[model samples]
Target: MMIVTTDQVAGYEIVEVKGYVKGSTIQTKHIGRDITAGLKGIVGGEIKGYNEMMTEARKLAMHRMVQEAEEKGANAIIGMRMQTSTVMSAAAEIITYGTAVVLEKIN
Candidate 1:
């Protein structure tokens, strides 16, 4: 499915609005990674473990959002956005949302 952050897709015209679609997932920090991250923070470097976790979370959230759009008979999603929020002490929630729509390619 086509997903864009803008309201409009360059080569496709929106013909039907299927309304809003959203998906979310929660992830928590691993104690082992936390320890690694703490040491890395002191040295000031990228936290690969946390980065990988967030990347996976985004993929899952986006996949769920796409599934919802498909269920709604939407071939595309516009104005797609992702949000990350700290839900608890060591947990974070990732949310993906957008307007589901059917698009026709312009000839």
Candidate 2:
């Protein structure tokens, strides 16, 4: 499947609009990692643990979004976007969204 952040994809024409598709997940920081993050805050540096967690969250969310698009019989996804927000202390929500569409290659 092809994915783009814009409304149109190059070398292809959108034939059918499959509407909106989205996927989301919520994650909480592990206590051990949180402790490490708190200590790192004192020195002010990148939090590897938190970084890894968020990275995995993004991958999972994207995978789910793609799965939804496949179910909708979409060959491409346009206007792909990601959103993140703090749901609670030590927890955050990750969301992936896009417009599912069937595309035909332009010859």
Best by lDDT: 1
TM-score of each prediction:
0.97, 0.97
* lDDT, candidate 2, 1-107, per-residue tens: 89899998888899999999998899999999989999998999999999999999999999999999999999889999999999998799999999999999999
- Candidate lDDT scores, in order, read 0.97, 0.94
The segments of candidate 1 whose C-alpha lies over 4 angstroms from its true place after superposition are: none
Backbone Cα, N, C clashes tallied per candidate: 0, 0
Clash list (residue pairs), candidate 1: none
Candidate 2 regions off by >4 Å?
A: none
What RMSD value applies to candidate 2? 0.7
